[model samples]
Target: MSNFLSGISITLSAIALAVSGWTAYQLSQLNLLIDQQQNTITEQQNTNTQQQDKITQLTQKIEQNKALISSDTTQQLNSVSTTSKAQNNVIQPGQFVRQGFDNKIKIELQSVKRIQNPDSEEKNVVVVQMRIRRIVPKGKVDAISLNQSRGRNPETSEVYRTIQNKSTSFTYINDLPQDSWGNAYFWLKVPEGINVIDIVIPETAIFEAVPISS
Candidate 1:
């Protein structure tokens, strides 16, 4: 009876030891699984942060582009407004139209006269008289002529060339002092009955609605 009781006690002790070892292994596995889960969650959080940063940067770029477009549109509108205002200031005849840079020269329309052609009574010569004065230079000045001048019939839009030989009287000048003005004539041959004309000069704006004196 005593031997049997000792065998039973030893078997009970072995079973308890095996059970404890198995419990420790299960705890270790649980710890490993928890660590792996935490690592996966951390990686996911990092990826989410990077994606959010990219979205923020794109938003900033879009706003910057909008601002640039608005500024360009406003500048274009202001340019158009300034051009319209300048066009409203119409330059008239007899008023001095300045040429070149500041104080270079100013030309004035003195008079417009019509004379019957000596060769043909039906034809007429239109004379456009101009005066030029120097403002910047003090002494000697260059000779000025109306060789390239033209006359335009506003009603018909017909253009007439200046007569070279007949205009040599007052068109060409050699002794025009600075600050003093001289006469430059432009003669155009046209058919009879046409009165008012437009004077067109090279490098100058057209003189419109100039009445011809008979």
Candidate 2:
């Protein structure tokens, strides 16, 4: 009976040893899988950071391009405006017609204004301001006539005469100063809606397409 008990004890010890070895192997495999998973997660985070940097750089470039396009558009608009103004001869600031022997007298358009009509209560008077200048001391500027026969509306063929009164500065034949630059104001009664007219600067030239201002 003692021999049988010793055999049974030895068999139980062998089974316990095999179970412990199997448990240890399973734990080692689980640890290896965890380490590989951690490496994969770290790589994914690094890729995400690089993609964010690229997105920020692209956004900065887009803003810079927008500003450049806006500046170019403004410059193009200004260029078009200046060219159109010159081509139409509207509000010519430096245009002048010269006459007299060797072109000594220069008649420049200073200002064109709309004034109230003296005879009527409406604003139907056109005021033409001319700047007459003597370029050479030897030449002469003939007496300019501001009469209905001299001023004509080419569109309507209507005549416009100067306002000649005791207080008005209407004269002939150098009765006024023939000095340097002199201001000559020509006031004429125009139609209620007439905005443009032509004037003959006697012995010089006929100024055409003169614009009227408000």
Candidate 3:
């Protein structure tokens, strides 16, 4: 009876050991599965972040494109209108013309001349002289603001800066009393072959296709 009991004990011990080994193997598999799931989640998150960045960049580009289109359209319309008005009223050198505004402000183109640049005689410059007169005694306008005017080359669609030279005589229009006049000058450095240039005064007037006399 003792020997029989000893054999049974040994068998039972072997079975328990096998069961423990199987449990350990199952636990190791479960841990590996959990690690794989975590790695997959991390990769998915990285992909989503990259997609969001691309979306933001694309949105910004779209907005920029819209603004550029709107600006271009407005410029085109203004250019067309200016060209038409200038064709009808062409002012030549040594000629003076008056343009009335609301019967209150009287703007005159005193002269437009092509002169030799003092700094470089070979390079020609176009000079525009203008006079702003207040007709109505009750109204006041800023005449020195003419300095912000710009010149445009209709042929090349390029905008030029108005240089203030020694010959430029501009009076502060805001300082002038009512029923007074002020003078301003604009100088443009243009290419030798450019025959015509346009002047655009914001909210004032557009002088289009003025011939550059040599």
Best by lDDT: 1
Q: Candidate 3 — what's its lDDT?
A: 0.70
Task: Give the runs in model 1 whose Cα sits over 4 Å from its true position.
Answer: 1-103, 138-145, 168-176
The TM-score that candidate 1 achieves is: 0.46
Give lDDT tens digits, candidate 3, residues 50-140.
9999999999999999999999999999999988756544565345444444445556675666778888865667787777776566545
Ranking by lDDT: 1, 3, 2
* Tens-digit lDDT track of model 1 for 1-214: 8899999999998889889999999999999999999999999999999999999999999999999999999999989987764443323464535453234556777777778777777558877777776656444444455676788899998988888675634322234445587666778886677777778876566777766666
Which structure among the candidates has the greatest TM-score? 2
TM-score of 3: 0.46
Residue pair clashes in candidate 3: none
Superposing all C-alpha atoms, what RMSD in Å does each candidate have to the true structure? 14.4, 6.9, 16.6
Residue 152 displacement (Å), model 2: 8.3
**Candidate 2: how large is its RMSD?**
6.9
Clash count in backbone of candidate 1: 0
lDDT of 1: 0.71
Candidate 2 local lDDT, residue 111 = 68
